[model samples]
Target chain A: MRAIFLREFFGYFRTPVAWVFLSVFLIASVGVPWFLGNFFESNDASLRIFFRFIPWIYLFLIPAVGMRLWSEEKKSGTLELLLTYPVSLGQAVLAKFLAGWLFIGLALLLTAGMPLTVAYLGDPDWGTVASGYLGAFLVAGAFLGICSACSSLTANSVISFVLGLMCCLLLVLLGWNVFGDLLLSLNFPVPLVDFLASFGVLPRFNPMVDGIVAFADLVYFVSISIFALCFNRVVLHR
Target chain B: MSAPHSTARIEANGLSKSFGEIQAVRNVSFSVNPGEVVGFIGPNGAGKSTTLRMLTGFLRPSEGSASIAGIDVLKHPIQARLRFGYLPETGPLYGEMTVVEFLRFVAGARRIRSVELDGDLIRVRKVCHLEKVWHQTIETLSKGYRQRVGLAQAIIHDPDCLILDEPTDGLDPNQKQEVRDLVNEMAAEKAILLSTHILEELEAVCSRVILLHQGEILLDESLEAMRKRHPLFGSVKIRVAPADADRSLSVFGKLEPFVERIDRQGDHFLLRSRDKRNVSDAVLAVSKDAGLALLEVAPVIPRLEEVFQELTRPQSKFIEEQG
Candidate 1:
């Protein structure tokens, strides 16, 4: 497992993928809030705009990062060698996922300049910033899980990327209040609509973004990541 | 050959694998012992790769078992995997890493670490002739270097058994000979199972063969015994004068039991035999006794190609029909 992690983690930097990905991620992560969100007009010390664009940015970039997780191995015929290694299947799955997650964590870490700038300029709530970072991290993990599972389904990285994008887009769409209201207006029961809405990314993450670190949201994101990794195992086991 | 060696280092017992309704391998059982190089030959889609995958613990057998060094692969895959080195059909290597980095990763994965890892790195680099391309990334190297890197990783742990699928598939003749020599060098200490399309290479290296056809083990025997099964095994050819052919035939009619059948070639009459024996002397004396002048007399050398074609004819026919 450790070997797999080391290979995958260092693997990202071996090619230009890591540098390009981090560059695009950093620019979009910080630039999106400064231009689109009311970053300067709000006149507030909080980084609400930055937290708002986290899921949208993650929905695209995480797929790009995770698409090659299994697809390259499968297409290049290295999957055979990987599965036959002395490591257990579960360990292999987790190691690969953690590798991608940590690399993304490093990307997220590079954006610390944004929060630090806000803290240095104005009286900012550190607790809320910490909670928002946690929320975004978990959201990245959940998005990574879906992409990893999609990656295992096919040997073509493009197919995996598109599938990952579609699945994550569906989850993001369901999180919107208008979509939930549309479902309720279509004669769906309140509990059933709430149940479906709870699976959305924002429903699980938005509370944490608001500095409300709920236990259930944390468990939900972790479970979603676990479920995705298990799905990765299933596709490979076949 | 050589009494089939001693302890079985690689064993497959009643192994079967199926995907949905199609059965890929069925009840395939064989063993490769220490000090034996077993050649696995089969046509494409004959379940050769599937069988190797099962033995390496990459694919699970549907109903039976495979063991490496006496450890059941399914029950304890890690332990079983540690006892053998498997080079998959494509010889996949991590293209992003340099040769040294990839070797270190494989060594680490094989549980060889620190000081031990350094020794293995030096050993495999030397054994596989990978010292020149040591610092080059796998993707930047040529096909031959990539293959050598693939082989270097397989042997890094110095396992007792080697399972290689078409290890010499794409190399030039010289590279193929290098790999063959390496396998031969390793045969004294390890049980080596390799599959190949080149029959002459098999004859040069393998002591025994396991011929699979239609997902079943058709023939499993020593190379000599399998070669003997070829129809042209002991056949001989005699070139006689065109006018003296019929007279030679009359002279040869007395040796019917020794020569099972004789057919006319362009310039020679091919004498078929039931067993491989010294019948050239008999033919010479018979023709000399009748005063029939002979132009030439030669015996056929049995080849694995003929035996392979004879065994895998049905599949060959299908391929031709498709074309």
Candidate 2:
């Protein structure tokens, strides 16, 4: 398991995908706050603006990091070799998922300079800033798990990327006003509407960014990640 | 159940796999003992790869099971896999990594520690003749060198068994000979199963041959036994005088016990005999009775190609019904 982790971790740098993902993520996370959100003016005690945009940022970058996780192995026919090793399918999936998630986490850490600068320039709510980073990490982990599962189901990296994006988009759309309004007009039961709303990205993620570590929310994201990873193992075994 | 300790390095019993409606392998079974080189020969899409995959536990068999070094592969695949090294057809290499780096990865995967890493790497590099190209990236190396790198990784763990698929594919004649020599040297201790389309390679390297076709084992025998079972009798060419032709033909008819069949062309007789050992005795008897001189008796050895063709010929309805 350790060997697989090291190989996969270093393998990220051997290809252009990791670098491209990091660069794009750093530029977007940092650049968007300065150019679009006007980080210096009307600054609150919180890094609310940056946290607000992370879901959109991860919508693009997480798939890029996860698309090649298993799909490349299938494409190159190395999955056979990998499976033949003395490693269990669960261990293999965990190693790959952790490697990709850690890569994105590293990129996110590099962008910490933004919040540090915000603190240096004006008083900022360090708790919200820290919670926001934690939320981003959890969201990235959840999306990465989904993308890794998608990658395992196909040999084409492009198909995996597109499917991952679609899945993430659907999850986000579940929280939108348009979806809720449509559900209200359809006269759906109140419980069903509330249940569907809980399925959305914001309902679960917004609490984490506000420093509220609700057990249900934590379970929701962790469950999704575990479920996706286990699904990946099943597909590879089949 | 724990496997009984034995010299056998690999064993399979009625292993089978099916992909939807197609049966890729059906009750295929064989074994390789330590220090023995076995050749697997079959036509394209004949389940050689599928069988190898099952042995390595890459694909779960739909029925039956396999084992490596007494470890049940399906029940404990990781344990079985730890005892064997495999080289898939395409060599399954990371093109971006240097040859040395790839070896290091394999060594680490096999759980070789830093203390033993240098020695293991040196041993594998020396055996595979890969020292010169160690620092070069795999993508930049030629196909032959890449294959060498693949071989290096396979042996890096010092497995008790090695399963190689087309080990000599895409190599020049000289490179092929080098690999053959390396395989020969390694065969002294490791149980090796190699699949190849090249018949001569089997003759040169393998002690036994397993001929497969349509997911069935057509033949399994030692090289010497196979040769003896289908021995190539020498062709006897005799030019007889027209007056003595009838007598010579009569003598040839008496020689049917020693000969497979005979063909006639004018006054010439071409006799294909099964008794290559007593060729001179048969020729002497025919010469004395027919008053015809023994012109030529040359031995035509049968090549493995001819043996393979004859063994794998499509079965007719009569043969199928009998089975």
Candidate 1 lDDT score relative to the true structure: 0.88
Calculate DockQ per candidate and list them: 0.71, 0.66
**For residue B263, what is the lDDT in candidate 2?**
80
At residue B306, what lDDT does model 1 achieve?
74
Name the weakest run of 10 consecutive residues (lDDT summed) in model 2 chain B.
B314-323
Residues B1-323 of candidate 1 have per-residue lDDT tens digits of: 11223544899999999999999999999999899999999888999999999999888889899998888998998888888888999799888999999888888888886878888888988899998989998999988878888888888888888999999889998999999999999999899999887888788799999988889998898988877776666778889988897777778777787888888765578888756664687888888888888998888888778778867886553224223
Model 2 fnat value: 0.55
lDDT of 2 by residue, A134-224 (tens): 8888888889999999999999999999999988877777876578879989998878888888888887788777877678887888888
True lDDT of residue A128, candidate 2: 74
DockQ of 2: 0.66
Candidate 2, which segments miss by more than 4 Å at Cα? Answer: A185-187, B1-5, B228-254, B264-269, B275-296, B316-323
Q: Among these predicted structures, which one has the highest lDDT?
A: 1
Residue B44 Cα positional deviation in candidate 2, in Å, after optimal superposition: 0.8
Quote each prediction's TM-score.
Answer: 0.93, 0.91
